[model samples]
Target: MLSDIRPAIVSTILFTVLLGLVYPLAITGVAKLAFPYQAEGSLVRDSAGHVVGSALLAQPFAKDEYLHPRPSAAGNGYDPTSSGGSNYGPLSADLAKRIKGDAAALRQSTGHVQIPDDAITTSASGLDPDISPQYALLQVDRIAKARGAAADEVRALIQRNIQSPLFGFIGQPRVNVLMTNRALDLALPKGQPKRA
Candidate 1:
């Protein structure tokens, strides 16, 4: 009985220290050294050298001068702690109603006959940082008007920020809303004030 108990306790202590402590620390150290930016949450900063947000997660941008992320259903929108979809199926009337309302509002705002799907729908994670290039382009005129910049200038900014697909074939082209908005602030800082 004593012999068995001694081995069990030794095994428990050894495994606990090795797996619970050492393993996590080792992996974290490696990650930090290899991917420092990502390990630090990919935080984005402004020209003033202040931390604004993360490049990986989505954030709400309600101002007309800024580019907006997708419709988030995560804890009132873009809540990283509660990242998830609304789980509304295609047949869900509530989802349909929301989409219709959003579409109508978008139509009124942009006046584009063909609205992009991403502009109206929420992403699966509800924290998608990227938006389709078309959706970004759609909001160019409104953003330009709000920022007191020319429409072509705003459109060019979006074009510069548009990221190509993974390996040129895997994924769709997307624009990081946060990055583009940051660029907007830098390019047209005259009329648009810095967000607190």
Candidate 2:
């Protein structure tokens, strides 16, 4: 009995140290060394050198002069602490109602252009920073009009910021809303109010 209990206790302690502590630390170290920018949360900064937001997480942009990210369901929308989908089923009435409302509003704003699904749907994490290139293009006219810039210039900006798929294959092309908004600010200098 003593032998069995002693070995079991020893194994628990050894495994705890190895798996719980050493493994995590080792992986973190390797990640930090190998992918320093990503390991540090991919934070974006402003012109004044202050941290603005992360390149990886979505933040809301309601004003007309900037591109909006996908609708967030995270606590009050885009709250990192509450990142998650609404979990509405495909047949759910509530989901359909919301999508209909969003689509209607988007059509009214963007002159009835083809609506991309990403423009109306919340991402699984509810905090995806990237929107489809099509969705970003949809907002170009609105943003350009608001900023009092030419549509072609704004379209060019969006085109320049379109990120390619990871390793050119793993994911779809996306436009990071925060990065592009920052670029919009830099390129147009609209003096728009800052958002989180």
Please give the CA lDDT of all the candidate structures: 0.90, 0.91
- Alpha carbon lDDT of residue 169, candidate 2? 98
Instruction: Give the poorly placed runs of model 1, Cα more than 4 Å off.
Output: 1-13, 47-50
**Model 1, CA-based lDDT:** 0.90
lDDT tens string, model 2, 69-170? 999999889999999998999999999999999999999999956899899999999899999999999998899989999999999999999989889999
Distance from true location, Cα of 38 in model 2, Å: 2.3
TM value for model 1: 0.88
The prediction achieving the highest TM-score against the true structure is 2
Clashing pairs in 1: none
TM-score of 2: 0.89
Candidate 1 C-alpha lDDT tens digits along 109-187:
8889798889999999999999999999999999988878899999998999999998999989999999888788888
TM-score of each: 0.88, 0.89
Tell me how candidate 2 scores on lDDT.
0.91
